[model samples]
Target chain A: MSQNVEPFKGLKKLNRKLAKLHHILKRDINISTVSTPTNNLVLCNSGLVNGLTEDQVFEHFSKHGEISNITMLPGKSCCFVSFSKKDSATSAYECFNGKLNISQNNRPVYLSFVEEVPKPSIEVIWNELPPGLLVFKNFISTEEELNLLKLIDFNHEQCGLLKHRLVKHFGFEFRYDINNVDKNQPLDQSVPTETDFLWLKLAQIQPEFKGFKPDQLTVNHYAPGQGIPHHIDTHSAFEDPIICLSLGSSIVMEFKKDGTHTCVLLPQRSLLVMSGESRYDWTHGIVPRKFDIIKTKLGGYTCLKRTTRVSFTFRKVLSTGKCECFYRSKCDSFLNCNIEEKMAVQLEKMHVHKVYDNIANHFSNTRHKPWPNVMDFVQSFDSGDFLVDVGCGNGKYLSNNTHTFEIGCDRSANLIEICRNRKFEAFLTDCLSIPIRDNCIDGVISIAVIHHLANESRRLQAIQEIVRILKKGGKALIYVWAHEQVKNKQKSSYIMQDRKNRKGTKEMNGQCLTSAQQVSLDSGNITLPVHSNRSNFQADDLLVPWKLKGDEEENESVFLRFYHVFKEHELEELCLKVENVRILKSYYDQGNWCVLFQKM
Target chain B: MKLLTHNVLTSKCIRGVTVGYPLLIKATNVKVSEVEFKPDFVAKVLPKIEWDVLANAAESLGHWQNLPKELPNNYENDTDFLKKIHRVLLEVEVIQGELICPESGRKFPITNGIANMLLNEDEV
Candidate 1:
């Protein structure tokens, strides 16, 4: 059976290669030369290399090998270099071919063997374009095109030179100093009165763009070998429906989106309106070439040679805040509400409970000493008062006030057992639904428990439960871990170290704290362990670690416990939800938010 | 589980049990170990406990004696009566038993002085 499987596996590999070859051939790209070896001549097919002289080509290629000759085709914006030896050509191809930042302009030079020079073919036709693209041929008469061109001074000395194209801004001075369109500063020259006629003509042609009174216009004069780089107009900088009117010569503009490509031909005196998906999602650019081969409906191709061309690009500056488009992927307003809910449940079951269970013994070991502030609150109750210590881990506060009947309760069975072993009155129950009667407890002390609730509503519910269990005028002391544990100066250093240590742990607990709260703790070696399964960590939740003493077989074990450290105001806000509870005092102690509230 | 803890316990958290207070005790095994008598603690907890429920639970466990059907006017100062209340509330522990919810008949087991009142997901 093994021998038979080997032959079948070989057949599968052969079938996959054949399928890939079929796809490449159907795309009409050069397949023969791409697969076969070639001579010692290499062709630079980049449009950027049109202005390079023979000396410039020799200077760069000579480093790889002894160049016999260099031929520069200025008309085609390409160059051919022949090396004296085959190895030198191979070395040059290996080092520089298809690599970016090899020339002065830092543009990638598309290098290929001279024999494998790919023939031009239309990548995509007009009908196959993505939605929100409309192109109209002969949108304006030849006389109207000539009249529009006459309004702009093509040979103006102040015209900006972008690569090989001549550009002039009408309403705003498009600054070349910055790569993006300048929106903060206004240009000295506003839109010319003559250009108003062209705007009116555009409105007459496309009624949808009638209300779009564009305040910015950029006229570009491109020579036969010049072209613009592929780019999507900044969504925040410009309004939709950018109009580009082509004049003097026809051209093919390529639109690319998420690995799919489409091309549309703009005939002379034609107007192309880009809005919606085409304006925001797809990138449009033109390849600088002397000729373009377009596919016709009859399954044939027609070659259109290039000449000097002029284009008018009109745009309206965005006059609003962030875009609120329904296409969230393309817009900036993409948020998932379902993921937030899932995270809350995961934080409880997976990180909080699982980690506490694993480190129950070790956690009890560290929690031996009760805080001084909590001890004071316990003693405040009368000698015979009945108090319940909610989330009373290891019964730390259970025996604090011997005179008062203090009952400890915790969700962890292991921790509850420890409480019972110490002879402290204890019970097992969830904080959301305690087994006790309402308005029965004289005092409730819930220390370091509320923060474990990952969701805001659940945190509020926990506080509400405490209020419900308290007797009228009964006081309850609640404590939650604070986000900012350490003071100001050491904050950044602590967070960096915390992140470094968190990477080594298997499970992450709560949300991540803000930068200010991420201060370094005095115990430098101690850092929280983050959960390994969860990805979203934008919140102030964290996983604290507990180190366990190991037996002879193992050294030491680290367990991660989930905690949602509270902001000072967060605990106060949660307490505000309980109807009858009046906040007596709220303060921060030992990096924990302590709130003392009483039932009315 | 002492009658004091059972006095505050309820099965209302269980499904199909709207009124779950005063759980019916069906004791298979019970122990009465004497705990320290705290007269003030017993007096303070008296108001919080449901009198009828405590009386019913104590009677079901066969531990009721000298417990009044109604509270005496001078109960706080009644030391003899307070000592009896303390014994029934804290000293009388169910070593091994079962507590049945009167409304839903859900049984919570008791073993080694600890009562397991946790419910299954479907039961809750």
Candidate 2:
């Protein structure tokens, strides 16, 4: 009778009976058997997975089902995904078995169902955060907060706008004009005595901060839709463990480092302590918006509305000195671990000579007019006296004195060609090794050249080369760019002070100070921004940009030239080391330290 | 390169190349142009030149005709001898040549009146 029925309908009835039998068998099996089906488990493996976190594993496998748990075996490069619903697991296994394409480190993943599942190494901590960040909820009582607010004199006249918020500083005046705390200069007004109790209470909350003394307090008032911009507290300006207590509202602050973003909630009457990596490496800020959208576990966002808030940030001013932190990248004290001498030489060759070669034509065009001081030196030599110009780019000084028999030498072959084309005597050589016999030339002029050398020793070597070639009583002039000539007054003062600090310990040769030196020495105690107008002037040892005339709009094509702007005493010190050379004259002319010395 | 410039050129500045003076000239191209004669300049420059080396260099370039094999005792006042010295020092140019260092045997090339005295990194 079954064979006589419609054949397709009879096949469908038999398949349903088989499916029911298999389901009953799977439900009845309790032992780990090969044929037993697991609906809520998925097995994942990859050959090249590394450091795959639990959150990443969830992000990848959650689309298949509502993942109840994910245990990652980083050592084995495998993981287990458990779904909340059996049907979702079945669907995922059916769709992905033997055809899953998940990959890490360019290695494809394999997915399948297994008869036995291995135990996970450890349970993943779901909401663990990075170190060096602390947040306390409702840290102060309502009455205490009201008393603290009363102690603060909210004077609109004194509150200045720092970005989007109104800020007033106590103990140390945080200058918004300079965007840093002024440690050397004390403010006219001091911290109010009414807040003395609040300082003691903070010390009680965190005993480690008791030594910090809470000398500097910046009261910031933020209305709705107002927040501070991202910044790391200046490392040299303050000691560690900056404390901020919030009042009257809840807000979300974002912390970022490298590319990772961590959102922290600062609730009303909360205290946040930032130290260690959080204080130095991470930049913290609040976005100026009416609402903040936070991601939920179900891949949805919940917005938190903003309200007016006030915060008091307390810090201890760091004493002025070098920061000897092991974290070299973030330390603000030293410029860098003293650059190796060989590496410095390599940098000079790569940044200076190579750049001159690339911009030989354009550089020659801009360097047409010889400096008047250099011209005077070239013209001082008597006619028929043999002279050489070291680092003589394009031979600008070569033809300045037709009376003298002059020859030019430069490291750039292209510049040598330009000199040859102009029928000026020239040679291709390095300044350190001039290839000229000793005591042969009457005079040598090196203009705007020695500063291209990266280290003091190399600069001295260049000077020695000129001295070696000069005859007894022969004269030479050297010009180096001065650090004191920056166009901006504030920046120039900073550079001047930095130079003085670096040169303070060295004994001066009892030389009288010029008017400019007098001014810089008088202002040596002040501290200012070390990195201002970086586009025009980089570090003391840095690659500065040179814009080509026709390609000014294309920033990528700009050539980087190396320079070590010389301080006045530094140039004089170098000259003093060359034996038998007396400093005939030293002066600043048009942004260059010009020194004229005679080989005795 | 004029012999006057060659007078001051040496390979001693090159590391490992001691006794580098008196470079042997092998000129493939040579030319002579008139330079204003200055007898006093020649007289003053005479004490600085390696006389034997200059004479050898001039002979190797096949331009030593009428030149004395040895520097004369009274040449300071002899205009004829000073003229020859001037011609070799200032007028004659080695348009294309090689200057071989005697010690290291390093050859520096000269082209279009400019001598390439630059050294390799290791040599410098």
Each prediction's number of clashing residue pairs: 12, 0
Off by over 4 Å in 1: A1-347, A483-568
Top model number, TM-score:
2
For all the candidates, what are their Cα RMSDs to the real structure?
15.5, 15.1
Top lDDT: which candidate number? 2
lDDT string, candidate 2, A1-600, tens digits: 122112133446544544453344345332122334454443344421554444444544566666665544446555556666667667766554434445464333334444444554343222234367777778788997887777565564566655477777888877542235657567776666665665576678777666556778888888888987788776766878788989877888888777566777787898888888888788889878765544446633345567778898888788853455455566654552244577666666766888899899988987888877788788887756898999999999998765567889999989999998988778999999999888989999999889888777888999999999999999999988875553322333323444443342211111111111111112122121222322223234545566665645554466656677775466877988999999999987766778999999
Q: TM-score of A-chain in each prediction?
A: 0.44, 0.50
| Ten contiguous residues with the weakest lDDT in model 1 chain A | A507-516
Stretches of candidate 2 exceeding 4 Å from the true structure: A1-255, A259-279, A284-323, A331-358, A448-464, A470-476, A480-485, A488-535, A539-600, B37-85
Candidate 1 per-residue C-alpha lDDT over A253-281 given as tens digits, one digit per residue, 9 for 90 to 100: 98988757787888898888899999888
Candidate 2 global CA lDDT score: 0.70
What DockQ does each listed candidate score? 0.38, 0.41
Cα miss at A359, model 1 (Å)?
2.7
